[model samples]
Target chain A: MASGRPIQLFRNMTAKIAAIPMILTALVIFVGGTAWTVVYSFTNSKLLPRANFVGLDQYERLWNTNRWIVSIENLLIYGICMLVLSFIIGFVLAALMDQKIRFENTFRTIILYPFALSFIVTGLIWQWLLNPDFGVQNVVRGLGWVSFEFDPLNNSSIVIYGVLIAGLWQGTGLVMVLMLAGLRGIDQEIWKAARVDGIPMWKTYLYIVVPMLRPVFITSIVIIASGIVRVYDLVVAQTAGGPGISSEVPAKYVYDYMFQGQNLGQGFAASTMMLLAVAIVIIPWAYLEFGSRNRG
Target chain B: MANPATISTAVAGADTLPLDGPQGPRPRPRLSRRNIFIYGTMLVVAVYYLLPLYVMIVTSLKGMPEIRLGNIFSPPMEITFEPWVKAWAEACTGLNCDGLSRGFWNSVKITVPSVFLSIAVASVNGYALSNWKFKGADIFFTILIFGAFIPYQVMLYPIVIILREIGLYGSLGGLVIVHVIFGMPIVTLLFRNYFASLPEELFKAARVDGAGFWQIYFQIMLPMSLPIFVVAMIIQVTGIWNDFLFGVVYTKPDTYPMTVQLNNIVNSVQGVKEYNVNMAATILTGLVPLVIYFVSGKLFVRGIAAGAVKG
Candidate 1:
């Protein structure tokens, strides 16, 4: 193939021509764009990007900013809680649905329907539901618990949790569906053997079945992790980083600085941090899945 | 144990049953403890999942007078379509008092072209990768899929520059390009896998018949891949329609998509906080995806599953 003439490029020219858009998007947009953002992060470009170098200055400001710190804190709380709760709820729902119960389709349709709605819709609905004035607090108070205080949206400290509730409501359905598929893929003989051995169903699940769904779990984690990093719209629709920016997230921070604040340097730096967060989540998963496959 | 009389009758009638077996399948008592436990748990979960939609519908149907007096979960005493009409025609987002209609039409203009263009490009690209097997096609494909994992923020500004440089910035056409670029990876992967799964014999036969790459793709591949095309359409339509980030970033206030506009309408601060109108707007924004989800039930699951497993 290397010894071919200069006309070798024209050999499968139609194929290459058909592939120009994919090639450009893969190389120019994805690779080129990411590199551009990282490079611009080092500069002091305010409204427009420039080559004026100011290494570490933007990063310093980003770290020193109170909103950035709060954003990180909110992301940590939301990310950790989302990861833990969604997994538990998803796996439990999947396991329950695995039982030979009736109306399986109806239950699944109901649970998974939420996944269809956009995060914006989910956030707004949840914002309404969590509204202190006439929402859950009012309902509970109307039910005779007049001292109920469930208004996370307006409360600065717990506003992130309000966002988390909506996030979980929208996303757990997908996780449940993924886990259910994984459960269905398990060999029935394993369950039969466990039943014959008198092992409890939960034990059979925890001790035996879960380990087999490692790939599914890993996939969900990567999906959810990347999703956690890109959680801008949900926050925007729900809180708009309100109650004094207590619910700020990195993605929103980037958007505000770049577009809203017109501070391109800060936006670039903040988005670079987001890129780093995604790399942290994706790198190891990529290595585990692809690296070992190459070696084997 | 719950039905002693039925058990006694079955036992009494045992002699009349086949000697080989009692029956093909055993019938469990519906009111058994285990059945009750499972059904009760599922019922509670289903209600929890369905609560938001239920609340949205009930709230949208009621007047503000009733909403002020009642809890959000209560059914409307007198249902009115006034809120829906208001949400569609009278709600304000920023300076636009024309409601979600502008956003809705903007989204239609954005989504229709985007879905069609992205699918067309991706399907052809997938065909080339699967059948033609150029020297470095797989390398580019790998990078494309990896690009999907990189946060869109990383690429957002650079693409802004790119679009601006190309004289398409802040235009509907530019937003369409952005959608196509972002949707490329998953759509391409979907098509690649689907095309690769097709029998190679057909391609080989076409090649032997003197069909070139475009000829074989057009004649053999396109007709056979309709279902995958529908799956891709489903994925893209919902995805591009529900897109708030790209629409907000790329387009001006006048051309915001439904999701972005819906967010603005509900969260805009100056308003007197019309809860009924807000709920109505949200449901209206969500209605497209919801309709597609229910209409394409199993296909929707398959689309998401394909997307999920692409990792």
Candidate 2:
């Protein structure tokens, strides 16, 4: 045993050495990429990167720009609307299905199928359905309701809600799945107890089941929130941030400035701001979740 | 045997008591007007959830003339397979006027290799972290989890730059590499969490039998991980197949994924809006992932639920 110690130690060292490359690659890609972006934010880059440092001018311009401000505000509205709407709709659907409804799998599939499609396709379908001249609105008008005026796509003020509808359709399926999983995990004895106590179904769901599913709810919220921050494809595919950029979100704004507007510095600055914002929100939540898990 | 007889006697007594039994219903019928009202409301809600898909199907079948007539719910006046055929054969995506059919091979090419490599690397990493217990394993896992939360949009610019420097900016290989990198976090987290959940006694037994790390991982752990492995493959396959941004950014025109073709075809500003063709193309682009989702729905849900509940 004493003689074997040296050989075992050598084997352990060799294993550690083997893992070094994997660890280093992950660190380099994440750390190196983050550093590169932060540095480029300060440079006078355009289309392609040029190495001239430009101090804080890009930051200054980003803050003062009206489009940037609007985009930020729009993202806040879009994010909140999408999150709240998807959550409520998903929860209700999951609850209904959990009631042992007929065609449970079929209904679940119909709801989840939208999630399988790319946002690009869903956005296009939505755009078509909402178009003023050739969509549902015109059809409604053709039914002799001359007073109907459903044209959110053309209305700069309310168009983001139109986009939010499409987003909700795609996202609610994921929320439903998460909630359904949570619901299925609940003990049947709890339901029996609740029923014996003369508790109604809705009241039981609201008080007992939903509270039990809090962790799942939080997980769903985090996933949906991530999608909100990265909501570019839908905007591009549907509105192209049109009707005078009323529906513009920060990601689209950054893409435009980076590629189309030829202002990489400003774009990178905006990206930095986005990163900072996400970190601010996520870091604390992650700490709570991960920290609590580890400590226990 | 005595306990069983006593339980049966108790059940017989409860059944004979009927209304006085512990499982007896309320004095009056509980489900009244309010219950019917609630069920009615739920049914309407279900209809609302299903309406858009109904419209998409109806519209896809309608020709331009019927579509222009603007009856979303009505059956098509002249239902035809023309649009589906046109979308597959003749739709104009760009300077290349051919349909989205051209991108089918490209998507398969990118998705197959990317899925295999990502899953393989993730399995290796998961094995190392779970079994090896190196000094920095916790820190490495923490960073990887954090990486999962960072929006892919924020990483795009930097990734593009890195790819360009490495001479992979506009190649199909580059896109595959990017997919693997982005796919790593979730895949690694999944397998690592799964492997951690497994019986440590098995590993101890394997070690006592003179098994090395690779031997245990390959012969013991990996075989036990088939269910989670299927789930991981489904997620990666669907994600990579339906990817739009990476496909658009990293791939040359010759290698555009079906999504990019669908996007260009449906999103052209100056071209006439061909709703039929666009719908057909959308359906086509969505076909593979949809099929996967349907077939693997149960496994996918189980896998995600297990991972989420444990983590």
Candidate 3:
């Protein structure tokens, strides 16, 4: 009995000890990091972080800044475009593949190969292809159709769309993979029944298959949404937020202020805003995911 | 299991003739039509997806004069390795003009240790959390998963400040620590789900044999986790290698990763913008991850599919 008591005590102690590092690391990185960013946002910190606190001045300045406002608007547009377009394209492609067409492995690989390439390279390739002087525009012009104008990368109004095109190219493959998995999970009986019902293939896809893949759709949306928020490298690589800051997004803006512009206060404020934006969208979904998971 | 004709006729309207029906020996609707439609659509999309890559490769191989002539799809009039050589040997990335070789070594230095440390820590943490039932263990796991959703860029400033205060900022050690810290969530998530799916009897049997936590984890759990270990390694390698903002913000110039150099080369606004050289450099920078993907394609799919299945 005495030996059993010591063993139980040791088990209890080990369990507690095992949790310590995880808790400490989480607290340090998440809680402490978030608090530090919030505090820095209120300071007059620049380049190197200074501790002279100036309440809400940076936030006020951020609100007033044209660049920050433009960045916010651009992010909204870009995020929505990327999310919707990639999903539609990915879903269609996956559906087409589900038809059990020939060269299935080859087609799947072709669809997925772009995901293996880094976004940095993907962005550069897109940039070259979108360059008016040497890209598709010139080729079209060479075909004697001189009226062609494919200068989206150069035009301020359309550059964001250009970026979206590149993002969709890289992202759709991932969405297709996810949706394909979902499709594969589906019972073959459903397809067989629908075929027996004499339902058109398009109707079956639209009415039955799409709705049944709700979980996959939700997961894809969440992943892609987070990706849109953190999308900096692609913009930096492709257009450099160029044609006069038309393609600027919040992450890139925060990066610029923190590093290039040497305005840490503004950078932190921008970051705080981004955090708030993400929280607004993610918290509710997170609550649902957790609540459902726990109930299950 | 109904007759094929009945199934087709049921789907088709009663008045509408069957697609394969004989009415005056109507033109046969070939079985190949549906296949043709599906394959043809996929082929078109594949071309669209691969078009830019085709351009990048062709552009990288062409002479500057050919590139300037502006036919991206056509065969290069004159092939040249000059751009590839220049990109590797003489591309300017700021005051340093030694191409990306130095940055490549820096990337290797950062990536190898970062992958090892993160995987080790995550494996331990995952084993403890999934297998050991402890007060606050669930909470800790939750927070770690939550940390994955928090943008790493948002945490960059604070992490830099914290590292500086500890007298480790701008050093290789500091960068490695940062990578480990950021990598914890994904690696832990990967392993925790993996361990959760594993049969508990294995652990119970090990315990009955008088094995302690560390012994069972190191000897048994770690060995069983080879598939996930590969997944984690691939993720860390690709992520750390392709990372630009973190590398630029964290490391000193002497320790800058290859992505930073690639960024500098491709991002130069003042230079005459050598399209061929930039394409070559970008492809070179991505070579490691591409190789990993090609070589470990099957393992990569299995690892990710397993993780996703649990979710």
Candidate 4:
């Protein structure tokens, strides 16, 4: 079974040729690009990228800038609220839909449809819905609650929450679908056994079933969390970091500096921070999933 | 989708709908206090989900005069196709008053080729990894999948530079390549798992019959894998269509994709705000993916579930 030229590069010539794009992308674009951004972030490149070193100056300015600070804080608020609310809403909806209710397809379709639309569309629709003159504020006020003030788009403080509403509206549907998938994956015998033991369905779900769906939960969290980090278009379409940059997110900050501001160094620094944030979330998940699998 | 009810009942083992069992009059299940609670809450949540879509449609149909009287929840007094017409052919972005036609065409150009090229490349890569198994293919595969999670911002400038170096910067072809690059990971993971799941004996049989790598992939793997290809198609079409950041970054303003241009039209500050036109444009931009979502139905779910599990 000895092969001639054991490690010859072109053994399977077409296969090797077919793999060139993936190889180039993995090596040059993804790896090279990320490294380039991190390195350029340390330099004083403005408008055009250059090798002129600046020794943390961009990072210093990014941190000191009010908009950047506000972006982080908006991200935190949007992240935490979106995280907590979407999960709760999603899990609850999944649980309810898990019931032997009628019209499940219709309900599921209606809910999941929003997940199809782009965030830009989501933002614009919500922008219209929240408009002070024609939106929820006017409608509610028209409904006899004349003192209603639900204009989060214009209000600086809760403008993030305004965007959060639209975000949740668009996102929770996917979360529900994912959770529904998880719920459906639960073994039926557990439910039968719980019923035989006289355990209430709620307690059965809370105490027994949720833990079994840990992988699904982890997947949703990672999906939702990564989504939270890259939430730029939604903000752009909805607020454009409006009424004095109150709802600016880190991703938007990165975009604005790099392209709009033409401050390449600053954008690189900001994007590097984004990269760091994603790494924080992804590294542990990768290790937990793959590391133990390798040995086991 | 093979009867949604049956699928749920099979998965959930909860066909306990009282008094309405379709198969032979089974004893009615007890109507517990819990039934009402479960459904009422779901109705509320469903309404919350349906609100924006309902509002968008209703708002888009109403005339600008009614929109000024603007109760978004109300149905239109007189439905008008004028806004749709305006959005599709007459809406303005800066001095470009030619409506969303430019962006729509630009997106069509970007999405079609990007989808085909990305899927073609990824499926082949997946085939090679799963079947051919070169000396270091898995290493590269690992790095490629890992790269998916990195914020595009980190890769954004570098991609620009790379595209520029390759003489594709700010061009439609360059944007197409960017979509292909970004779409590679999930598409590859999808096809790899798919191809690997096939019976190994087929490949062995084909090999003994003198089929080479390309021969097997082209003759065997592809024809058997059409459904997975459709699923991959659904994922890529939706994803690349919805992408804003890459389109905004990689393409010039004149060639911006629909989502980017849609954002510009709705959020552009210079114009006297036209809510009806904005709503019309919003729906027009979303129409492609939304239509796909409705038509593809169950496959859309399968695509996302597959994407979610791997990605």
- Pick by DockQ: which candidate is best? 1
What total of clashing residue pairs does each candidate reach? 0, 0, 1, 0
Residue B188 lDDT in candidate 2: 81
TM-score between candidate 4 chain A and the true chain A: 0.97
Which portion of correct inter-chain contacts appears in model 3? 0.60
**Model 1, B248-278: lDDT tens per residue?**
9999998788998999899888959999999
Please list the C-alpha lDDT of all candidates, in the order they appear. Answer: 0.92, 0.80, 0.83, 0.90
Tens digit per residue, CA lDDT, model 3, A1-296: 85887676567566567656677779988888987998889999987888899999999999999988888888888999988889998888988888767688778777877777667777888888888999889999999999999888999998988988888888888888888889988998988899989999889889998899887887788788888898888888889988898989889988889978999999999999888877876787787877798899
Worst 10-residue lDDT window, candidate 1 chain A? A1-10
Best by lDDT: 1
Please report the TM-score between candidate 4 and the true structure.
0.94
Please write out the lDDT profile of model 1 over residues A1-296, one tens digit for every residue: 66687778787999999999999999999999999999999999998999999999999999999999999999999999999999999999999999977789889899988888998999999999998989999999999999999999999989999999999999998999899999999998898789889999889998999999999999988888889989998999999999889999999999999998999999999999998988888889999999999999
Error in Å for residue B281 of model 1:
0.7
Winning model by TM-score: 1
TM-score for all models, in order of appearance: 0.95, 0.91, 0.91, 0.94
Total backbone collisions, model 4: 0
> What is the alpha-carbon lDDT of model 2 when measured against the actual structure?
0.80
For candidate 2, what is the DockQ? 0.50
> What order do you get sorting by TM-score, best first?
1, 4, 3, 2
User: Which regions of candidate 3 deviate over 4 angstroms?
Assistant: A1-21, A47-53, B1-31, B305-311
Instruction: Give fnat for candidates 1, 2 and onward, in order.
Output: 0.85, 0.42, 0.60, 0.85
Clashing pairs in 2: none
- The weakest ten consecutive residues by lDDT in model 4 chain B span B19-28
- Alpha-carbon error at B68 in model 3, in Å? 1.5
Q: Can you tell me which runs of candidate 2 are displaced by over 4 Å?
A: A1-25, A195-203, B1-42, B303-311
